[model samples]
Target: MFPKSLFPIALLSIISLGSVSAVDYSETYVGCVPIGTGTSGALYSPSVYIIEDCNFACADAGYTYAYFSNPASSFCSCKNTGPAPGDISSVASGNTNCGSFQATVNALATDYSFQSCYNSPASDDTTSQSTFDSCFERCSTYTNALVAPAGTTYTCLCSNTTPSGTAESCGYDGTFFAYSHTAISSPSLVDRRRRRLERMKRDEQLRLNRFCPGGLQACIVPGSDDSFECIDTSSELESCGGCLYGSYTNSTAPAGVDCSILRGAAFGGATCANGRCEISACREGFQLVDGKCQ
Candidate 1:
């Protein structure tokens, strides 16, 4: 069960999940534009083979615009803004269109309000408005404003794209919001963040495994498929090898002792290794036999 106040927020998140859609290339102007030939900008790598690849690269790098030239060669370049109208060459059959990348909306709950609108390098402000509805109206004015977040009072912050470290919270005591211009409601920005979180989770799990290789006490079984457990196994006598002692039973005994000698030694000089008990030496006055002390 969840608190009634949280239901709306949960519902909004669920609704937002369904809104994600593919990128739209038509919003941009497509033409053959050579990099460094017409404008002064930094050249990227050959890894950007496709238009989407270039767009994502530019977005991740915090560039407002990206251009892919020589599709076959995958030459790409990023810039703070697209090339000038005069610099654009005739539209080529294979060249990608120059357009702003779509941004995802991120909501941040805050305890203070924004003193002023903080726009990114390529952001457009909708001025101060009284309501969220009025702020959304300004989104229509900026052709590239894909992400718009209503700020304190009537201010609206809009941007053409979002970067990896884009601020989630703007002002003190102010709630941040965002919207997309594309039909697909889900934004790539959110997707990127989600992927990053998943990677972090995987890395954390790997770290845990490295620290506790044999599995932590009773919480995990050393060699079992389902090894993870929540119960504390550190002091468990039965699971000395990180699993139930009975699980290691052999023809010689119903239960095997762990590596420690604290458990009474029923068998002569018995030692546990890899979940199995072996007799390397016998008790005093005992003579060694075929497999045990006689």
Candidate 2:
């Protein structure tokens, strides 16, 4: 699929959409728009990705209108300012949107907050630029809590528990951008093999919760209904030091602190030190003084 940012400006102009350059175009402006840093594009969604979804996302980003086109793939572009009066029919031309699948993207996803693009914190990691599934897996795997963009890169960011600062009006640069999280995806993609793996992992974690280890603090992973790869609490980012919510299956396995998910310790500068989480950095505009991002 063609990248969302590469969609021609002429197409945007015809639909009364703003260019990626932050310039307000007349409703009749049918010229090509210059490709720019991926800022002007407010948000992107998968294929029942409706015009209303784009409108809602743009409105959250302080824009008046949104463009949803699926000539090849789903693309949602946000435009700022007002559309100067002009020939409305000429620009309306052959513009159309297509998202036939159900709202599967929103069903399984955890609730997420949206704003405009922000200076992506130095992310702990990034997923492959394939689809939302990759981003979803990576984010849930690491924190299951907070996820941010990695600057202007095409992948979802793996950052701290929360992000701070204000969102930009139009082209926010790497600044934070808001999304509705009401994504639309094909049925097969949503119920793919990777999703099954996630379910398996969940069941395995639950088993460990039921029959936990006291001595080694081990977690069960396999068998017809069993598995391997115990949760290494010592260095594991998700389960650092010890399990945060441990209980005895038939014995004791008390819960411990989870360090990698320190609130406000964004920008990916967190580490497990001596069975405790050490705050090494914070997100932009925050001072990491006295072991805290203030």
TM-score of 2: 0.24
lDDT of 1 at 273: 53
Cα deviation at 5, candidate 1, in Å, is 54
Q: For every model shown, what is its TM-score relative to the native structure?
A: 0.25, 0.24
lDDT score, residue 103, model 1?
19
lDDT per residue (tens digit) for residues 238-266 in model 1: 44444453222111223334534533334
191 Cα displacement, candidate 2 (Å): 8.0
Query: In order, what lDDT does every prediction score?
Result: 0.38, 0.39
- Stretches of candidate 1 exceeding 4 Å from the true structure: 1-31, 35-40, 43-46, 94-139, 142-294
The residue-level lDDT of candidate 1 at 87 comes to 40
Whole-model lDDT for model 1 versus the true structure? 0.38
